[model samples]
Target: MVAITGSSSYNPIITINTTTTINEKLTPATFPQWRAQFEALLIGYDLIDFVTSKHQCLAIDGTKSATSKAVNFYWIRQDKLILHAILVSISTTITSFLTSCKTSHEAWAALTCLYKGKYRTRTMQLKEDLTLSTRSSRSVIEFLQAMKIIAYELAIIDHPISDDDLILYILNGLGPEFRDIAAPIRAKETSLKFEEIHDLLVGHENYIRRMENQLASNLITTVNYSHWKGGISSNDRSFSNMGHRHNKQAIHPKATPSSIQMNLQQIVQPPHKEKIKNGLLTLLHRTR
Candidate 1:
């Protein structure tokens, strides 16, 4: 093999692809999503080194050779492209403060300084929100989603909360009806992920709703059946009283067979048909 003269290879020039636009401009409230999108794009292109300061600019002076000048030009061009990407992605409110920043690293650091400074207060507020969250009338998925959003925000601010703590927060916020499920999860020694617990909670919520509906239906059916039976018993009592009174009048001590026959005939012709039929039958049977 031939010996290498200057070097085997040279560092490739890094370039930022400006065609991919960041969807939203940076604002105080939007920093987390905006940072994520921007960072992901930079990372995918392998140009994150510019903003992180891992790629430093070469120095240029009167003593520098043509090769040094060419390298410095390439570095400066790439830096300007990255800086432009950052400036355009920011809102006018924050971009005004970054006007003096000339390099990608400076802009990136400035943004972090401005937003990361508020992490302490923001983290406290997020924690409080998560702690106080309640399911109330909302669906289980909605409740879980709300809590997850707060957790995500916390993570973006560099204050990541554990899954177990989040699970505890969820159990605390749920109604007492969920105690059956909550107790077992609380007692488990093994670590559980959010996805597994999510399915369990949702399924349990549906079961509870079904049980409540079934109980309500049974109660209604019982009340209706009792009412119907009571109506039949009341009518029977009225008919029995009519029959007994007719029979008592017919068996009077001084009454003759003819008089009893006349009383039975009268009983068969009037008022309620069922009561009349039963009353006449009772009188005839007693006379026989």
Candidate 2:
């Protein structure tokens, strides 16, 4: 009987496990996003220790005893298990490179080396992106979010940016709309935190929106007033035209049969004869 004693019940001496399935797996595309989480998982499973080093199972002086052989076999089995777990997390394309690695340590180092180069290149690209970032037509919030993402990626790679530099970059990238706020923040003797700058810029943006709304309201009021005035002017022109027509009718009254009939009736009426004679006399005087 093989005697097994260890602190944990699931120790390799007590139990050699079956297939290990991790909830979170790694792929080439997700390597950057999931690398930290995957590493944490590895640590949780106690498999990181195996990858970090090969466990010494025998005496240094090349001793070949039953105890040493059992210990070596235990180490080998554990290494294989850890290696299988890592391989399961990786994708087929990258898995090919790690297939030849006999020990877990070798596989881990190979993956690290491969990803580290890519990480450095990615870091450089992110740094360049941050340097060239601009607000342009983007909203203040949108611009800040983009810059912060680049900064975050750089920080993850151990190339952290200072808040002062970040503030300066933000100030530089801002469009003309934010100039008033950015100028004051830049003129300050002490460096302002990014949060302070963000608050000021956001406040200014809100003020701008309010002012825009007020201007629009004023414009609408002016347009409506102009339209009302135009309607009144149009009505006045219509009345003026009607008055002109009445004056023309007074100056050049049409000689119709009704006028002749009215004249005959007035001539026959003794009561209208005096008034008709007075009207004729006035007309003759005015014509002269």
Candidate 3:
């Protein structure tokens, strides 16, 4: 196992490739090696513009004999993973909620927050906090609850959590003072968590709300109008349709006073040609 450290103190404790179980092969800019490179880069706190590759972690093919347990992709998922959590924040929507930073005071304050940073992506596991343990928990609810419990402790309530149901409902969340709080503490925790979660989430929902006023701002998302309007192909089709109609008036003379008085100059125009043009024009209009 190896360790990577940031140049400065502000960075989170990010550990990478801290294991000898590096089973896969490494490529210069390819899979396992690429991620190893990224781990190395993190040591200096340098921002990488793009991810170069994916690494392998497990192999599941029907390879050599008795047992078969494998994972094909080897990436930083283990390090990035916040997996194996027991409890977490409960929320209604994905994009609509804002999870707060995991802090030391959350458990004491009867509040909960997101364990990972906003820019981070992670997965969660569940716990036996009775409030959510027995009900039909959807994926989102289970996940939120697990994340909350991990970051903060919950106050224990007076309600009897029998020995048999200990596996089902938690007497208190995992933390230092969790076992001591009373049942009424549950209400306070629930209220604070709900309200703070709602408020923090609302902030994310309203992030830069009045976008209409930021037209000239550097952060504005601008798309080229000309690109959206399409190009010569679209314009040519429209012009071709109008051109067909315009040619008729240009070639055939109108029955105005001056037009009617004008001499033929040489040979008389063919009445059949004029009738043919007019007939074709009428046919086109009818078809349309």
RMSD of each: 18.0, 22.1, 28.7
Give candidate 3 misplaced runs (Cα > 4 Å).
1-194, 208-224, 228-288
Q: Rank the models by TM-score, top first.
A: 1, 2, 3
**Residue-pair clashes per candidate, as listed?**
0, 0, 22
Candidate 2 clashes between residue pairs 3 or more apart in a chain or in different chains: none
Candidate 3: count the clashes.
22
Give all TM-scores, in the order shown: 0.73, 0.60, 0.14
Q: What TM-score does candidate 3 get on C-alpha atoms?
A: 0.14
Candidate 3, overall lDDT?
Answer: 0.30
Task: Judging by TM-score against the true structure, name the best candidate.
Answer: 1
Q: Write the per-residue lDDT of candidate 1 for residues 159-252, one digit (tens) a residue.
A: 8889999999999999898999999999999978999999999999999877766654443343234434454355445654564465656334
Give candidate 1's error at residue 50 in angstroms.
Answer: 0.9
RMSD of 1: 18.0
